[model samples]
Target chain A: MDRVRVVGRRILCGILLSAWVLLPASGWGAPLAPLPAPKAQKPAQAELGRRLFFDPRMSGDGGISCATCHMPAKGWGDGQALSAGYPGSKYFRNAQTLLNAAYNKRVFWDGRLSGADLPTLVRDHLTEAHFMLVDGRLFPERLKQVPAYVKMFKEAYGGEPSFGGSLKAISAFLHTIASRNVPFDKFLKGDKKAISAEAQKGLALFRGKAGCAACHNGALLSDGGFHALGVPENEQIFQDPLRHITFRRFNKVIGVPNFMNLRADPGLYVVTKEEGDRGKFRTPTLREVAKTAPYMHNGALATLEDVVAFYDKGGGSGPNKSPRLKPLGLSADERNALVAFLKSLSGEAVSAKEPKIPDYEIRKLGDN
Target chain B: MDRVRVVGRRILCGILLSAWVLLPASGWGAPLAPLPAPKAQKPAQAELGRRLFFDPRMSGDGGISCATCHMPAKGWGDGQALSAGYPGSKYFRNAQTLLNAAYNKRVFWDGRLSGADLPTLVRDHLTEAHFMLVDGRLFPERLKQVPAYVKMFKEAYGGEPSFGGSLKAISAFLHTIASRNVPFDKFLKGDKKAISAEAQKGLALFRGKAGCAACHNGALLSDGGFHALGVPENEQIFQDPLRHITFRRFNKVIGVPNFMNLRADPGLYVVTKEEGDRGKFRTPTLREVAKTAPYMHNGALATLEDVVAFYDKGGGSGPNKSPRLKPLGLSADERNALVAFLKSLSGEAVSAKEPKIPDYEIRKLGDN
Candidate 1:
């Protein structure tokens, strides 16, 4: 009977070890996995997109570019809590990272933009009155004047410079921006030693007791769904009159159904007009979250620790707060571990050489 | 008689070539020459300085850095006609390049600060209300909080962080930033084929008919003297109330005798407080002049051609206009050649890697 009992204990121990090894590999109960490679794009098309991305002449004032806010050094998001838009304008929402954005079904914080194609989003951002402030019809003419751009467009699209061609090129470039070979990714791909033991413990907590995997799951660590996390209001917006006015105007223009609280940003409610959808923002991908600080839709939190603490405390006070969020009862060590795990998601730094802009003579109004 | 004529012609040709070479070598009629290598600095000290230079935490709001305006990508100076200062403030003068700045005895366009030692200038820039707005006393305390900075400071200065130490370190780094081995420098060093034929012609014109060498001369291509070039007033300052207010306030604080025309920026007169000095500004170094566009103290000229044209037309209309700036009567070809020569002054691009700033817990107020 003693021999049988000892044999039974040994069998159980072997089973546990096997389960630990197979868990992440099978993706049965794992919270995260390695992000899949994106669809390949033509090198020339992507190259044209890259040039257009950095060209400030794409804006009305010739001062702003796609790279102005989406800086590579700052993890494709300007390290500011709120990004500067046009000269005197400010953005209401925090600038989101372009990394692995092509994997998302929707774009923007509120998910107002639908579908994976990014040209429409690009067009909206370029022509938006408070954003780039460029006229779409006149923009093509500016590109056509640059001999280098004209040549590049011809090579990339087999056509002259046009509005559609510009959009296509930019979108193609966006699709190529994917994160890979991160520490977390290596760990997910069966390398037990890739991440620290503390991080491995954090991964377990992230999937189980912390309950973070409910919303933040899959390869991108986002469900591509909207939720009201009850992020606190940014007080600076209330203090600055210009910012307040810009915010109100933007909401009004977008036809947000509820205007009762002019100070409050009603995230996804603007698009759905559903009373239930109030304060709902899309779940942002956790990839490169360490570098893109001042977290959340309103950028109220300053660091990953603060973000983790907020979640531990079951988010801020609000009527529309997610029911899934509850006090995690996390220890300080667990909090640190979670932060470390999140930081490990940051892959190799993305950088590109600034393209040489083709010099063109400034044509005055009515000059041939 | 035929042999005598041939020998005479050879002698004259030899004499002309010898005179041409000797003229530049003797600093009699040279346009520009090679920049001397700066005294060697401790790599550790310079490395610490580099981190401090790029760290935005040096600013009050943790937003601006030395790299903000003096970007390596944009030839050290930001490619703005006038740079944006502290949030709402706009600078009256254009951002000057930091390249070979250590060689200058005077700093700033107005020459308010004198001497090559950069600590005083560093102090002024840090605490200046319209600039970084950082208090020196508080800045060192901020640096002490970061473990990496504390370690680096100790290694570099052999003591705890201090305001003086910070300044000394930054100044030490700036002293190492010297321009060298430009195309013009190579040409000056007896490489006849180093520069293009057009540039060679331009060099002759620069020393002779153009009279550029009168003010712009020496190894660094600056005589380090003030002159009244009668640069036109920038109308944009008058349009913005905050900028106009800031401009008036800065001049008043600096003790300019007359603030009669708020629009009129009385360059060096703000420092000297003399009638003769009213519109005088320190002649800027022409090294890398082609890259630092929107020329002059006020950035009135957009391109090299515009600058050449301004000189050709004998400067703008002003009471204090220098008598030295007589019309050059340069033709279009000569103007193009002059621009080409100026372009040759730009050396290989200067760049530095952004340092990894150490992360520390964000303490909310007074905390040990």
Candidate 2:
């Protein structure tokens, strides 16, 4: 039985290898290059952050960890339409992919915070009511009780366990995650046939006919700008009271007018607090597009085809929908090609194994 | 300034000594005998338990520790009428003293659990909604994250950090606590000069006129029985919505009928679930009576004088008020003597300094 299983796997691999496209090495003419490598991080700090990224104890209930949402296996995005929030609460937004996040100048769907300040982003996620719900004052003490964290903090920051130090350590670890070798990068580096012919046609449509390049044209395929794409709302927000409560609470805390009755998410308005910014969300990076699914601020589109179709039909209705969104009237073939090109942007799975969480101990008879 | 302060203190002490009572050395007539010493505990386990007792991180929010309400300086009980509960909630009952807890046959205000199995008691206090509110499933992981707790658990219970082990460790520490040297105990040991003549007169009334010994008897000055003394309700339960919610929730979860509208504590009915048990409560130990002020289940009485006066006028109205409660018709002089005798039951403060809580560390890089 084992021999048969091994032979079966080898035969499947053989077929896949033959089916795999081999690009012409000499003629390189890709439109974009790979993202610039993320800044190098301190080994000790990064190491500590890597462990903390998976540690659930930092949460209010010790049941939710950073990795619980930003899972490495699922393109650093939980494969859910909306985040399965911390215990007893529900979230209203889709989990965003964290891959190549190091290159982002701005972070979060609304771009309210700077990517350079990764610690702040981490703090927001960990302490936000619908997320980890951690109390800032009490979390450090949670770390203090664990002897292993004390030594790690001392080694990484030359200090004891501290809230700021932990965040910075996690930020340092973020620097280690970025887009790796992909066919698009290979094509940019003078390899003519890295992507298939159909993908090439789709790429042209992206730049020309579809006008996707207007906002998604950089190496990360993002302008880092907010736009009102008019993505439809996910009905689950209003249907589930837990989700509705979370939505209203977020809006209320951000001083949104009539937060109790606002049925739709304010998106970028959360930051600008301006009516013009309503429904506008940051243009997200397209890297690792294939691995992350149920895409958009509210995860309104389930597939790349659905996203293309939405744009082909001039987008959904919103208070401040962008004028740039016009009917594309693309043929069925053109639609498939666009999705194919989008898929080409993704590389192999980038992941790390979860570390062993250490147990607490009595330090000594005298020292607690 | 220092010399004058010292001289002033010495003069005050001199005046107090002359005013203090002195008893006859030969007469040895006391109503009750001294309490037996608490059972010996394993040193390593007891030491571990002692430190765990002070570690606030064991709580749900890391803001309430075992020592938070059971303060050593205040007779192992917080000097508040109602306990300052875990964050985000309010307690409805008076903080019970931990002193002589090891000697009790039953525990909790309702005597719902066995004192011999202290882990059960600790579990209730730690995880109960209005108390610590700790999630048992997550707390073990919290302990696992702390390196110090890892070692302590191993030292105490020869295992990894576990929910049951942690509770047991806290229980082990409880065993170390008990009443210490008191005047009444000294007098029972045949030292007649240990207590004052006024205290002696009060002792006679305790076993006779006042009928106090009918219930407040034995080593711990408790009958290990339940009774309905008709203690009035603490108004805070009705005044503070936070406390009221906690009360309603506690009752609701305990399967109490008509819990939401039941403004008064159900007392022993919480355990027996019988109507006859309404307003009945377990007799609390009076070993450290002097330090633990604001007495009774709801802390309706602020001083020993008030308690004496209450019993002197029979007890308050309750569904099942004890028939034993009757008017004492004692004079003001008799009230003072009774109060003095109650004071003799107390001893020097039993306390341990808070241990240095350890900081967490990053263990080996590969081991989280």
Candidate 3:
């Protein structure tokens, strides 16, 4: 009998540990996760990364810097559905934000990318990503020309003569993109009057009937898990394997073009290449999404109202739809309150005038 | 004998009281004029004025707002010798900062536009003096086409509906354009370490050897006086009046081609029309002149060094030059230190983005 009691105690401890691990990644279908408390200590790497993030020298043509796309003013994402690519090339996907991305295990809409390591991700974004081409060439060759980048990279990485210097420096910057203090955050911390009455009503609806909290729980508003939401499949997944590499893992076709001449995006089928995984996409963090307009994966919706209405209507009747998809009846006041709470997520951001680039003499490629 | 002694005692008492009355304003300058100590009372009118001051609707064209010239970001002035005139017009003088203007008895370089009130000045700027024009027409007329202005005007002023509401509303705003809390202000308030050691040294030089305090003194940094600093007299002032009128005031000539070419400026002569007034401009407040670059009335010098150098060389020696203009020999370090101290004079300013016009329908002109 004593031996049996000891075994039961051990089993209880294991279960508790497992639950804690699963909390952040998936709480039913909730996407929100509580942010870690900010450290009072100022990390030098974060400061360096912040400078690089704002500086335009990281880009090839100097016209499209990192800040141009991942703008702090517009919720770390350009307000555009897809950012205008290097110089003027059109991109296919909306610019994903970098807010609290350090907490993320997997990055991007399809979960084809994973790992919280900054350097690897920065390198992939600058080189492998199709969006950041400069002067009709890749960023690596063009970045070599800017003297400021050379100096910054050297300072950030002990003057190392490699692109790794830049990657490390930029990743150091990304760690600082933490969510600001929000009303909802305050509400959970015992301030019953923190959120407005309307928002409180909406929150109740979210946790109860709407089941939004099922997928949008925690502080960051992401479960960090994927769902097959019955979105239409794109045929482009088969034709353009390079772009569809991530979606094909779900064995789903990329979305076809809309009748209105809009590009129909394959939400996640391009990554997994599994029939069951078709239209499966990672839940997005709702923090600051109000400012990043033209919502959804393709930016098909113009307003937050449209997004809420779409979710309420149970999405498109496409194949491999999640069982979670259902109509959520909500009043107009409830919807408005939800939007109001979403808007309150944004706060005054720190801004500084663009720094003047110093004049520098660069040696020709062969001169060295 | 008793009557005589009583009379003498009364006389003595009267004399003592009279001395107390005359001592503060005259002996200590206007800063000690028995006025109430600068209180922390937040003036609602000043707040209203601040809103109007930031509003772009006051300008003729929506584009050429007050911020276009007296920029908050670039040191309370556009970083130009002279501000570009509205649409296609010539600017005759350098843009003057509004800092501490409330303390001045005289206004403009020529000291010909002095008023005890702010509304008159703002009106003059809006209607006549270098206003923003669209297709060679005043901005108020253009505003008449928009319905929004009518509502804004109504809300801002209590008067019955009209095209040009209350000019006093503008004056209320200008009254709030105080110099920022600079390091010197901190120093004056007993924080000796607020200013750097180098700046302290520069301040000593300014007060002692340079004798800058003699003219540029008191709280507002001016004695509300005018002086001829031996700048070049306009040739057209004494030569041709009509042909020079085009040069003297806003005209199409300055805007044609580049606005930076040989500008036809009349300086102080436009105001006084006296030979002695040709180079006699007002002793402007140096409150934040470090930010308002292209120093001097005509914007002849591009930097503060050029300004100090001009003063060090007794200004450009010419007719009607002030006797105060005399050469002073200083080391390069001393000059740079002076610039540093001057830059520290700039205080907190309003940001450009916060005061944008709300989307409102244009009011029809005939509605009033």
Candidate 4:
């Protein structure tokens, strides 16, 4: 049965390659993120969360916001290298797309913190410690001080022993952020004709010899762990404006330095302070990576092909790079097959609303 | 024929009285704006104008905005006792609803200016002179300094001689603010059954015994002139915070403000500055007035019935009131008929969209 399956997969790849050569270039770009099933949520909670999401007053500066980074129209990620903070800050990390963030066990790249439900994140952004932008700024504090928010938070979470109007409200909202089943998923569900034959062939390679399932797997196509794939040296291409990595030790516990390495983003290493963890970055979900271009933690690789080819060549050379970082030695056909598989990872498009702060708040923010 | 019309008008009044008794009090105090329309427009110029209208960046403090007063869902007027301005202002005059300003020949209560159009008005708001809130620290100048505005303005309006950018863009946009045809207009166009029988009778009474047609007439139900039916005397109501009206006095020979009364809004007196013009506010269009409650320039009356009753008693007693003002001695039935007719003036609702600023701008403002 396994032998037959492998043959079937190879046949599928052949059929897909022929069809892809005949297809248009536009057909190969990022597909829409799939729509997640509607969460079985209390209408009141969802409505409250929705209201809070749209309210600009929730942000620190009364201007920077979740919607600002995770624009629905722009595939839940602002199409920028790095997100801006209050007063136009060039934030260090790219705003990760928020498509299936509800599925994430650990949030942010470093994984220093976990179990940060929704409202906690929301309130923390408003607090002085987590987000410093709102500390002295007049806007976010104003929202926190508003009578309406207090009333609303009390209603949503119910003030008392266990609840404090934090993560409960936000998590209820994030619960709605599930991966939308894509054309590939549809094809996987016996709708063999939904996706082109090329995609099917790519899927075979992804599940078979390409060894992608070694890291990216499951419905989200991610294990949410870190790996150091041997791609090009980080310092070779892009100028390292903010140094994000430093090697503290060698083989014992190689960890990237937290003091801003100019080469590559130090990522999870800074948290563990382990030596072997050097250059190890979180394995981001492949769910919506097509639309989120300039891939990798530092946005080093410009295309999926670059990523796939890097893997095809078994990652860039590095002392602490994972054993899984070896090249797959793929043929052009196989490389194309891998590309097709990555393309299949794109999900259904999620609708996003543009943010609108009330005119009163707009007046208060002193912004456009 | 005239006699028959008079008899029909009386019968119409009778029917309106019955309907008024039938309709529950549920709708009495609630606003009765027009029903919404279904359509989408992608005109860049109009979109730009909309952005400017909602953006506080155009104001002195980067705060005050056209939308601050003329809210879309709330009958194009802020539903407040009086408008708020820089440093928490409490304007004496009500925020006049912009239900159908595109159809009016004159703008504002005092009718000081005309022909400048909507974009010009935005420009006037932006300028250092006149009703300039931009300099008052209401809206900062950073919004105007953005490179995108220059590009958008140039695209919307050809530069230089035409005074391109926000002004020209908004002017083009205002051209689209035409009021939708209402049921009454449909009835007027030979669809006798379009309006209820009571409304028809109410319309007749409005034209005859009620004498509302003297000021509220034509397609817009306004003559775009001023008359002082006694409104309560209040020293506080003199200043127009919206700056929708400015008292300019003109010498007939010089075509400019030659003389002006300090204590008077003087409607058209801003131009002529005649003694007779004192206290004469512009005749506002009755179209869509149902949706904009708290009638008159001060929003004193809470309902259409209150408005009819006020008219029945002529007005609150005041000096320099119009000579045409007098107690109509309207029967309860006749007053109800008048209210019905006024309700009929409500037009089809226009769609409103919340403006979206780019994420870069949102983030630049701050996290809030």
Query: Best candidate per TM-score, number?
Result: 2
A190: Cα error in model 1, Å: 80
**True-structure lDDT of candidate 3:** 0.55
- lDDT (Cα, tens digit) per residue for candidate 4, span A212-292: 766676446776787876445444212321111001111112333333122444566677777677667777888767888
lDDT of 4 by residue, B271-356 (tens): 56576776678888787788888777766677899988988888776547766557899888888877887787776776568666
Q: Output the TM-score of candidate 4.
A: 0.41
- lDDT by residue (B133-158, candidate 1, tens digit) is 65454456557556677788889988
* Model 3 CA lDDT for position A112: 61
Candidate 1 chain B minimal-lDDT segment of 10 residues: B359-368
Which of candidates 2 and 3 reaches a greater DockQ? 2
Q: Which candidate is the best by lDDT?
A: 2
Q: What local lDDT does model 3 show for residue B113?
A: 66
In model 2, what is the error at residue B247, expressed in angstroms? 26
TM-scores of all candidate predictions against the true structure:
0.48, 0.53, 0.41, 0.41
Candidate 4 segments whose C-alpha is farther than 4 A from its true place: A1-39, A120-132, A136-141, A144-155, A158-167, A231-263, A359-368, B1-368
Q: After superposition, which runs of candidate 2 have C-alpha atoms over 4 Å from their true positions?
A: A1-31, A365-368, B1-368
Query: For candidate 3, lDDT tens digit of each residue in B48-146?
Result: 455555656454324456667777777666776655554323354677876556557778776656656556666667654245321112233333333
**TM-score of each candidate's B chain against the true B chain:** 0.89, 0.88, 0.73, 0.73
| Every model: iRMSD | 15.3, 18.5, 21.8, 16.9
* Alpha-carbon runs more than 4 Å astray in model 3: A1-33, A38-43, A55-57, A60-62, A134-154, A230-264, A350-353, A363-368, B1-368
